[model samples]
Target: MAYENLNFKKAHMTFDEGYFYMFDDGWDTLLQRLADGGTAFSYPLSDTIDSAVTSLEYDGINFWTLQDPGAGTITIRRWQVENSICWLKNTLNFSTFDSDTFTVEHYHTSLAATASGGTTDIQSASYGTVITSGTVLTLGPNSSSQYEDVTVSSISGTNMVLVSGTQNAYDSGDEINFYNNLWIFNNDGSGSLHKINARTGANITTYSDSEYDNITACTFARVSNVTSSTVDALIYSKATNLKYLNVNTMSLYDTMTMDNLKVNNTTIIVIYDIAIAGNTIYRLQKEAKYYGGDYSWTYYNYVLSTVRRFIDTVSISAYPTILPNNAVNVSEITTIVNDQYGDGVVNKPVSFTDTDSVGFITINPAYTDLFFGTGEAISYYKAGIVVATVTITATATQYD
Candidate 1:
């Protein structure tokens, strides 16, 4: 079974045996766990977490969460796993290739037209179909002429395609070459290999792979013999149907083609946040059971997938990590006007606690009741005159 704290600023969560430790970083609460007197490793949320932390979960080593950077509704992030693979993806195309062969001679600066298909203002557009083959082209357009404007009847290698079109004539001297945007680019470098961070929960290097321009949620899956590095560089994701990336080389593979990403049951995977622990991937799969009239969606968090049967295994128990908070530290020192002299305090206000409600100050990554990160929490504070700096006493105690 898995558990979570519903508190908005649930900044930290770690594991100690069977218990889960949690704390409110916004309010600086003490570390509280699932069980008492247990020692668990602390996974501190980073200072970069956004304000609108919608949800959170842990996968033993690191935390996975959905954040609203106020930019997009969903910004998926993983914490503590600092090692990220940054690569210059060579996925954009700038050239082309043919199956087994290509021919500059195959293209003719000329074509033969004939008045066979039609013969009026509608014009019988028939090109030389017994000498040229511009129909087997791929991507943008067919080279042989299987288009609405130019349709090929029969063509191959040196055989011309008997195409009929809206041309006034069809005999010879017409432009016949494959002009496709795909021919202007290179093959999708999706097969290219990449690197990975060796440490679990290590941040992935920020490299732009615009090819993955989508609402993609990703996580690492440490698999054996998957790469050449001591660091397992496989990234399992729902960023498009890609199964995993041997990030050690930035190379991607199909889950079906490679048989890597397999669904154990018929649970359709609608990926949310993904986290990994103990070589298992904990996915958040949402399910909506249809009873009679309406369907209410239920979330299944911590859906485990082991390394051995990572593709086939269904649910299993794992832990959650603390998601890093991406909040900006607004620690600038400033003085406010009251009656001059020495307006309250200055010099980078580290701790802004409003003892008196005189005037209010504001900050952001707007704090909400639904946030989950420890990043910059929005707070409102007020001040007044003659506020002398009062010393306070405090003591820390070990929890049992």
Candidate 2:
């Protein structure tokens, strides 16, 4: 399928080992098998709905679609998969702002419980205090074996009061999942970020920052050595650069400049999207020159850098191989930090030191910049009749 004509709007990788590509040339969603070039199925939006499909998400079990019928109205539908067939399970309606893109993130919580359709209460062996009021949950295996999102309005003992009745009858020991937030960012460079409760469909908060302007795409990843704990950092591409934001702190964490970023000798024009699965990061970038007529798409996959660091340095002085005796000479040292894969690691700090304790050694810009992962160190020699030897070393910390 050609991705031209803005057909490839979103891609979702399910637990089934492949990806479901959503195309919006009037919207046609299809799942492609990665092991072989074959189609699992294709669902056309025009066949069932007249509205435009804005986003499609697979939450490890079933599928969900977000549609916009215009005028600040949005519709969300859940599709149940059973016996290799797809069934329309539920349709949820809401009134709010309009957006072209919607990102659904599953909160890190799971519980098993039993409940019936048309009921407002669900019972588990014991919920304890793990779930509270305003918390969003998803009940699995409805009457049609589908999943549905519900909000906990109140909690008492081991029971939960859902904001609304359950759509599908869930059995004992049925898996219940939780949802965190639904993100909708302005694609028009407004820097506005709107968050909605993914389970309750309620607007959580809205905020803005100039750093978030012109966002092209974003993904959640808990990259080691870059971010702390189990919290996933929101990696968003603004123009050609990628910025990392801590979701917990809602603050900037790090930035990756992609102006000269390349994969296999091809320079990336822009980053279209980013996705992370386990320790691997998948980035979709434009390989074609911007507005230059020739165009192509490229994919870059790499293991997250918890790799050991290797430093290579070269020192150059005014003299060819030896410094003049009884004269002052300056040497410029360049240090390049690379991981085990030989790829230059950017935005890393390097420390330079020399054995000279007589105060004639100095290093400038002791840290690497966004453009280059290199540092400079300058050393001076005092006028002396005796010959001496000094050893210089460059050090970069390795992250586990």
Candidate 3:
């Protein structure tokens, strides 16, 4: 009902949790503002600090700083590391821990996913091997190798003691293997990415671990809570690109060029920070403009990039378990996809199938996709043509 607009020189910006932190070159202060603009506070970081903070990224707590031109350095600082959300980053791939003795029931390859959703701590399959200490387990999707490794310190029964450190957990149906290999990538002509064993510190420079050429700062922008074969990230070069890093394949899944938006009116720049919280992809942008001899700047916070919601459950409209062979197109079988909010999803791919081959199942893409379709059409065969208990099923393929 009411609004207020605050304008200040934006030298750097970051967003995490639900707050927007802004900094200016002149004032050695950090402006911590609530995302909704309900409240804000400013604290002194020293004029040197404010100007040096060319760009910043916040993971709800603490700051990952990308300094401006004069001081080309990447630094992370916060109140405290132990209680901070730094553990919830893509750079540090550690998993949920319940106890010291956890068993690696199975190793799911990235390619062939054996586990489905909701089945955690238990793999669909199990490894029968009785191992010793120092054996590293690479866990994730088998085909992708976009996995995390856990080194064993000792073993008892079927359980093993993981080398105490920060490690991410793997889930069921994920590909698990006996290796601690990681394809570390840097701009090395020796290699674009190196296939190195994290445990042994052995680097294979010629393995060609990454497809991202001439790019740096390969950090992750986590969207979904699940860790599998992919990591979402904003990779910058001549242009800002959205890249999916498949840890399984040890390469980039795909690259999408993000269309730039002009912010400062004087000039526009690439997005500086990105995060996927729930179904929304959020971005923070920055630009600099030289006024007189002094530089003026602009920063846009919490820009909605895109909304990608997944199907939590599929809702089926009223349908008959037993359809008469002679029944006409009187009844329609509809498919519905719902997110966690119990609302029908849009543009999500759904397929319809009926076991009774004698009848036809017509899918209403226009209606069903829009979440308000009349449903589906079911035309059963005329009497005495063929009789079978028709099992009509509707399933979701993807979320748009």
Candidate 4:
């Protein structure tokens, strides 16, 4: 690799060796150049527009102005709305002169709404107050004792008709009406419109009536699906309209009614691979074995005997043995006591002897031998044979 090292002695270097000299004076110019490139454009020092640019000009297509603060200083301000001018004068404290000329530019307008009768045909009613579009109207000073009344007669496309009246209540219903739907307020504080189904008599599913009283300020409840085999049941709440109550069993189910099934709370068991759809769940009791005896195992079955049966059926014949052939013998040793005052009394000491046969037996490896050998003799001998003996002596008395 070829490299060149150039050194400068002056603080500022002029273009010399066919390359421009970039001097770093502890400013961001070097940082910016290193970030992007040496030929990158530098950012502007100030972004505020000059305040002296004036002399408005209309170029037939657009209007603009340039302000000159004499001596070549210049500023440019755009012509905005009158509110913007007021804001600039009052809020921003911009200096204004009477010589500044305001120019108006020509634009295009359309009469589509007037020609199509889209905006003119729609009428308005009172919502208790008189108001107009694009025009402001103040409230109060009405003779009918009504605060404000403005009514919207119809709404079409992007246009609407509204009217104001002094009377609080109108002789006719609201000018606007929803054609297909009606609102109902439930007594339980919930309100909704019955869309898919209609209510009739005690049977809420029937749609026979054309003019049923509107269910306003009434409790709204859910009724589940009902079937001929079983009556629908409502699980909670007294509102029968919204819930499914089993007429036969008096049991309750949710909106989606189900066949009334008897639920035995005590007999309800949990079994594997079983699920509770409504009020029913089931379970199975299991059995197991230890030492080839039946043992009650709760919930699930753990079949040790089945495992043994499986082992027997297999070709593998090696069975697990828990104990050795030799039986473990446990003996208790006792010391005999003689009674003196209990009728049976003797002068000489009596001796008691006990002998226990201890042994082990094992089957021959050939599986032919039944009995092996006799056990060794175990004996216990007392000190002497005695009928009665009593000895008592007082030692010391201690006070507590």
User: Candidate 1: where are CA atoms >4 Å away?
Assistant: 1-50, 54-67, 72-211, 225-231, 239-242, 253-269, 288-300, 310-400
Worst 10 residues of 1 by lDDT: 97-106
Lowest summed lDDT window (length 10), candidate 3: 97-106
Per-candidate count of clashing residue pairs (backbone under 3 Å): 63, 0, 29, 57
TM-score quality measure for candidate 3: 0.39
Against the reference, the lDDT scores of all candidates come to 0.31, 0.54, 0.42, 0.22
How close is every model to the real structure, measured as TM-score? 0.29, 0.56, 0.39, 0.13
Candidate 3 on 1-400: residue-level lDDT in tens?
Answer: 1122223345345555665666554665566677664446666542244335444544322344443333222222232122211221222221111110000111223212233323222222433242447765555533444445556676654445556542343444555455333333343343354444433444454344334344432334444422333333333222444555544454554544433434444343455445455555555443322222222234244445443434556666544444556746334555656543344555656666666555655543323455353222223222223665556567776533
lDDT of 1 by residue, 1-400 (tens): 1232222123223332454444333532223343333434334443433343433434333343333334212333444333231111111111121111000111123343333335321211232332233342111112444222344455544334445443334443334433111101011243211122222222234344534433223444344422233233334343324255544355653241112122443334454444444444444444222222222233232334443221111111111211112222222212221111111111111223333344333542122122321112233332334344322111111121
Ranking by TM-score: 2, 3, 1, 4
Off by over 4 Å in 4: 1-147, 157-159, 164-400
Model 3 clash number: 29
Query: Candidate 2, residues 274-319: lDDT per residue as tens digits?
Result: 5555554444433433333444643321112121233433333422
Better of 3 and 4 by lDDT: 3
Cα lDDT, model 3, residue 173? 55
Preferred candidate (lDDT higher): 2 or 4: 2
Q: Pick the candidate with the highest TM-score.
A: 2
